[model samples]
Target chain A: MLIFIGLGLNDEKDITQRGIEAAKKSEEIFVELYTSPMPNINIQRLEDTIGKKIRVLSREDLEEKSKTLLELARRCVVAILTPGDPMVATTHLALRLQAEQMGIKTRVIHGPSIVSAAPSFAGLHVYRFGPPTTIPHPSPSYRPTSFYNTITQNQARGLHTLLLLDVNHEKKCYMTIPQAIEQLLEIDKEKILENRILVGIARVGSNKPELR
Target chain B: MLIFIGLGLNDEKDITQRGIEAAKKSEEIFVELYTSPMPNINIQRLEDTIGKKIRVLSREDLEEKSKTLLELARRCVVAILTPGDPMVATTHLALRLQAEQMGIKTRVIHGPSIVSAAPSFAGLHVYRFGPPTTIPHPSPSYRPTSFYNTITQNQARGLHTLLLLDVNHEKKCYMTIPQAIEQLLEIDKEKILENRILVGIARVGSNKPELR
Candidate 1:
């Protein structure tokens, strides 16, 4: 059996009791950090919390050599740990499809996600959010124009956008609110528009989530 | 202090460990079910799990009679329990704004939500989803036109639509997926589309989440 356990958001304690139980019961555990960042806790912290040693997997290991994990699922309980909710990224889905194709039983232990948590934590209405857009750092060669377009369209309709700060795979960058605000302001100046209402949330799912 | 605790997608166990601790420490606990539906768990089960009795509130009660709750918050720790993530609905946002206006301190406890969970659980990519649209039962005056528009648009772009079912306040109606699918098919026929892929999920946070 393959159990995809969501480590919730932020820390090791963010995991549900059921998810913890599943992780403990599993024969082998693998933590994938490529999907989303769980910056609060480390592999050792997770291992201590769940009482199991977790082997970390990269994008290459998951996408290229996933058959070994699938084979492990056939013999024993294999738990795949992910930040926030598991399966938010397509790699997780592709793995699930591979598991299904191989006839391995699979289960997803749901966890708290920022998609829902962000709006709630920031005191924003979900219905008022048209769509969420990710704003990346402006590059000379690659400018994410579509993201700006989505923000403008949603703004015109009086909808809030969940501006996800871009992650640079090459530089190991987690874009901060200040950087995002700067980018938004730059876009506003270039496009000749005013700043819409933006909410900045940090450390969501923690006891003290900072909102500004 | 008023703490808004998201009860996540299912029973009391769906809450984070921090949320459970907050509930235990709270002097008064209240549950709001207007924004989202409770998945297969009753007040008794919740009280049993959390070891605290929770008073239930409606939209009107949370919005209109909120002074009493705020007063309780001022005196002691009060938890506003909600299904899904708190502040997903406008009512929660309004309540938060009101609390801010009255100089009442408020905190939010994040939870798993159906917004992203619907697609995540269904093995659909969250980023590919366009602006999500809700589907309501066709009425004489106000039919669910946006439902069809969103579905068709998402299909055209090879994206998925996480269609939230409508909730009837008077009858307390939680529209099931079968009903939603039928409505979609009817609307799709009018638009001359056929054989589109659709996924339906029920009681997502529960142990036995029905998926089709």
Candidate 2:
């Protein structure tokens, strides 16, 4: 059996009770925190809470060596813990497909995700939000502008856009709200983004969550 | 203080640990289950689990008699329990805004939402989903065909559409997957929806969740 559990947002305690139960029952646990920047995540605290030693999987480990993890699931109950809702990322979905192909039964324990949390915290109606977009930090040779187009399309429909900032956990780099705004300004050659109200949220699902 | 607590997708146990803590600490609890159809929702069971007598709110109560609820919040900690994520409904968002305007503090305890769960269970990529649409049961002189248009718009962008079937809790009428698909077929005069694959999920977040 292969179980995919979401760790929710921020710290260890944000995990749902159902998630904790699954973690306790699983014979093997693998956590992937590198996909997103969870600033308050403490591996030690999470391990202590679940009473299990979790093998942390890097991006390469998940993409290239997933068969090793699948092999374990073939024998015993294996849980893959991820920040936010599991399978929100394409890679995680692909991994689940691979597990299914190998005749492993799979289940998902959903958690509170930023996709819904952001708008709720911002006092915005979730129904009015169009499909969300992501803003990635530009590289020297390549910069994607599809996010800008998505924002414009949503704005034209009188809908709000939730822009997710890019994260590189390996390099300890995260794109801040200010950096995201700056990128938007740089990409707004058509001047459609001018004077638009933007809400910035930090540490959502935490006790002292901040919104501006 | 007023807190909006999401009960998640299915039953009382689907409420997160954080949500349970908030419910325990709350002086008064109000639940509105009319907005969505949660097949496993049992008000008596939920009240028993929380160890509190919950005042159930109807649409008229929430929209017309909101001040009465807000008055309770002014004096004590009041928690409003909602199915799925609390603020997903626009009416809930409006109530929160009203509370804020009346000098009441509000917070949200996020939970597992169908917005994320539907795609995850369907084995479809979450990022590939466009803005979600609702399929309401047709009434004389009030057949809404916009949902069909929305589906076509999403399909044009090579994205999938998550269609939420409308429910009338007071009438105990929930739109089934067959009803929704039949409605879609009737409204697709443009013939854009023919032969498109539709995934139906039942009892999500339950022990016997079924997806096809």
- In terms of lDDT, the best-performing candidate is 2
Q: What is the C-alpha lDDT profile of model 1 across A1-212, one tens digit per residue?
A: 89998878887767776687788889999988766777677678778877878898988788898888899999999999888888776788889989988999889888888777887677666655656778877879977777777777667666677878877654677889998878777767456356445678888877677878
Clashing pairs in 2: none
Among these predicted structures, which one has the highest TM-score? Answer: 2
Give me the runs in candidate 2 sitting further than 4 Å from their true place: B42-51
Looking at model 1 chain A, which ten-residue stretch has the lowest summed lDDT?
A: A189-198
CA lDDT of A105 in candidate 2?
A: 92
lDDT of 2 by residue, B92-210 (tens): 89999999999999988888888888887788766677788899989998998888878888898787889999888889989999999889888888888888888999887777888
The RMSD (Cα, Å) of candidate 2 is: 1.9
Q: What is the lDDT of candidate 1?
A: 0.78
- Measured by DockQ, the strongest candidate is 2
